[model samples]
Target: MFTSRTFKINKICEYLLNAKVKRCYPKHILSNRSVHDVIDVDINGVKLIFPNVWLRDNCQCEQCFHVTAKSRIIDYNNFNVDTKPVKVTKNSNSLQVTWDDGHKSKYGFNWLKLRSFSPKYQKKYNDDIYRSPKIVWHGKDFYEICKKHDYKDIVSSDEALHKWLNDTSVYGVSVIEKTPNSETAIDEIVKTVGFTKRTHYGEKFVVQNVTNTSNVAYLSSSLQIHTDLPYYEYCPGVNMLHFLVQTKGEGGENILSDGHYTAKYIKDNFPEDFKLLTNVQVEWSDVGEEAGNKFYKLYRAPIIEIDSNDEINRINFSIPQRGSHFPGSIEDVVPWYKALKLFFNLNKKFAAKFKTPEGNILVFDNIRLLHGRNKYEDSENNVRKLIGAYIDWDEIYSRLRCVKVKLNLID
Candidate 1:
């Protein structure tokens, strides 16, 4: 939306009418228009600011003006040299130069209504290379960890699967619809894709029969939003829940929050704690349900991760599942506890719960979305059982962004 905003446009129009090589510097006649002001420069050095859109077509880059591999041909005749020139600068030593775009070529002093040019050794720009992304472990080892599951094909089309992934990755969650019931269906959805069923604490993939529950209180209980565990290695970044049966209750709702948002909010507003979470790796563990044995493990992950371009990219949140603090773990030093409290409070806003039916696969951006449920009344004899699965971070994103590129939908 950056644009020219001056009344000097009429001055440039006058130059276009004359179309002479007399106009070069428009500063004298510009009527105080700023250099940043998009203008029309006449051969007479008169500044007549022009509309912004009119110049987008004047690009000399290969994307707009197809160049040969040699790039030696100078299409000077096609240059729209009649436009008014803005303020001009010179090389620190001798020749008078014009404008500010890193170009050092000496020309006919007619750069009035055009883009500034310098001796560009390179002609193309690649934004992806310049970005400083924080995501690590995208190399061979990570692939080896994922490639182990090994299946012929989870989805029918590579292109189609890529498209479907974006819908789930960008948003906090995605749904797979029209699936029929059975353990076979669950395996078909996740098994071919090679998802590791991450289990820690006591909730990895707990399945219960309505008829077998000894605690009657569980039949009517509501689940709060929590990570699968606060302790465990990797903490399983993908969480999927499939409904086998719909409860007859009138008000049970599912909710989710984006850790990406919570992390970014804190990074920008609470620099200190954001610093803490990224600076140190914490330990997490699960106290076993068994009376005699307990299990524990640890991991190193930042609460927030940004891409090379510095966009809020990913989140690793499952604090409750973390093992015991590591030896020599730095104790909380700052008023960061207050900021941590506030960050989780902010996550409270992303809660979104709704009724789910059989055959729906609710997939979450395990690194980002916090899942929970609302309380509902249920018949004592008929409790509900939920089926679940998992997927990885890299595979899902690769699929989603590929589609976004084709559809021109990525933000």
Candidate 2:
């Protein structure tokens, strides 16, 4: 009686550790469905039915998976779809499967529970709740928590690097201070994040007030808040601007607005306009000439992009880059402009203004943060110079995930 009671208590503790699975699948079991050619496992409340071939293919043994590299070595083509398990048995905390071809595979309960492809977990994933954690900020208070990291610490310490990456991921922006005021400093910063995502502008673009400007960014004019490369089919995901020289005078502040926050406010206040912007496709193009190089590109997409869960994923609002030709009927054109006007006004209202000093680097999500520059005069002495670059989210998130793994922030 004592031994049985102790075993029951241990099982209860284990279930408590896996509360999510235990709550969903209270009384779980491991069994084989020979007729279906699959293995069945009932996690506390969740039922997982995986194909036999999938089980064999995902085996993590030394022969199947490289322990060092943590990658699969199994030749998937060697396994047939009709593969079936000859026997299935449950050990203390694992399920053992013996294949018809005399292959054995072992999967811990926790691993199987996490890797389960059940409808419940699939629904959770589709719900968009498991995405990178985000902390939305609007107005002046946003500046209070703007995380800043030293350039040296970012390159040297994984902890500091992770903090910067995590802050950028969650807040859509971050500042890197004490950056070396050299042309190559941007490369080091970009390397920290991953790599530069080159565009038609080149691997790196220069941002400075010039006599005869090559692009709007080169001219001393107020740039309306917008995302870069809205004209590209696959717009660059991350943007970084390292200030080599801070401009003198009153009107050289960089404007940054949380596109996600602006869109959410519009959705809540102007539902009709929000719906129109989300549905209508607008043409964005950049046709220009620089150093005898002619460039013209166009792309059509809704100004506001929403995912399946009705959450804002992207905001493409570039007044200068927008093409003259608008899509849809004449009646829809007026509503589209109305929606654009409302959105633009909201962006201006909610934008945060700050002057980036020399040796400071600003990193933001091109997809979620709308950035612009204030008009400034180019005196011989107080000229502004900034080096700009881009990198995709794949690289940024890869680095973030790597750091998170090293820091044990995720399993």
Candidate 3:
């Protein structure tokens, strides 16, 4: 038989695990004091204090918070900031309070526990902690990891589709094998996640050597490592390349390096370079006129971007697409060059080379993985052709969430 203390502890644990909270009366109270405009209450050896205004504003009743939308409907101007609670008493599984305004508020102990500001519940912010699902990969070992799905399985079975998306989300790259060699095939893959992210290049772009090439990628030349469309304000999230023709080739192997890993390496070894790269903003532009289509896209952004929490969010890097114009202080030119060189060297050192044969599709996070191809000359007898498309992470993330819910992975 469990004691009252043990039962209460078990209940708290259950709430933490599944949010299956059981409302039980407070058994023991060490302290209950009205301090200023707040009420400090101690129960089960845990100290918690509730502010009068905060308690009134956070009432969960239908009158205060809408039951359908679950949003607060209380007028902000109605509550007094310095209002005092006339009485604070413990009710079943809650703290019942009467404010000086004669307004009654009842707060669930479980709800308060969830939003506790106690030293025991507070977690010190750590710079090393990654908030998103940006997993870093390194070395040739990354190539060894092969999470491939059949084209039919992905389209037919939700389980297979979810697994593929999960792998791409977690690893930032995944392969789909035995796909048909057609333009619609790549479109199908994009539709599985979301609609095609139409860009200046249109809906679908062909990756093949052209007679008059506007982009360097169109020609059969060695392309340096880069993420596509760095100049776009909202860069494409995921890139899908479906190889329709990958004949005998000596140097057409794809070169990929995890930008997150490269960033981490620079931060760990060359902290100065990392800081400079993250702080210095550079101009990226795409100027061209091909087949009567004229477009010049340009945007200024830092090589490394950090989120509000100071975690590395995205790496906007494209050497060929970088504009030559220097917008900042002339003194920053030398330092910026040095920092960029160090970063490029680190990326080169960590890059992995792989080849996607015909009937194989490559999908990777455009924001996380920097991709390129080795130089290969055009052959009259053998030709290499690939169709590519883009999809935003918003769609992929939504699909992932839906899949998880369907599988009952989350409540």
C-alpha root-mean-square deviation, candidate 2:
6.6
lDDT of 1 by residue, 1-411 (tens): 112233454654454355442243333434545322453333333323333323433433454344466243335554443333344433322222232333222323233222321111011111111121222221122222111111122255544454345345435456666666764466666643455554532333533334344322134455555565434445566777767666665656676766665677677887887776555555544444332335545555545555676665545555455444553244653444455466567676645546666666677766666666676656655456567766666544444444445555432
**Model 1 off-target regions past 4 Å?**
1-160, 191-204, 207-220, 289-294, 300-302, 305-314, 322-334, 378-381, 397-411
Backbone clash pairs in model 2 (N, Cα, C under 3 Å; residues 3+ apart or in different chains), count: 7
Better of 1 and 2 by TM-score: 2
Candidate 2 TM-score, C-alpha based: 0.82
Judging by lDDT against the true structure, name the best candidate.
2
TM-score of each: 0.51, 0.82, 0.77
Q: What is each predicted model's overall lDDT from 0 to 1?
A: 0.48, 0.79, 0.76
Q: Which candidate, 2 or 3, would have the higher lDDT against the true structure?
A: 2
158-230 per-residue lDDT for model 2 (tens digits): 9999888878888999999999869998888777777788787889999987767757878878988999989
TM-score of 3: 0.77
Cα lDDT for residue 88, candidate 3: 71
- CA lDDT for candidate 1: 0.48
Task: Choose 2 or 3, whichever is better by TM-score.
Answer: 2
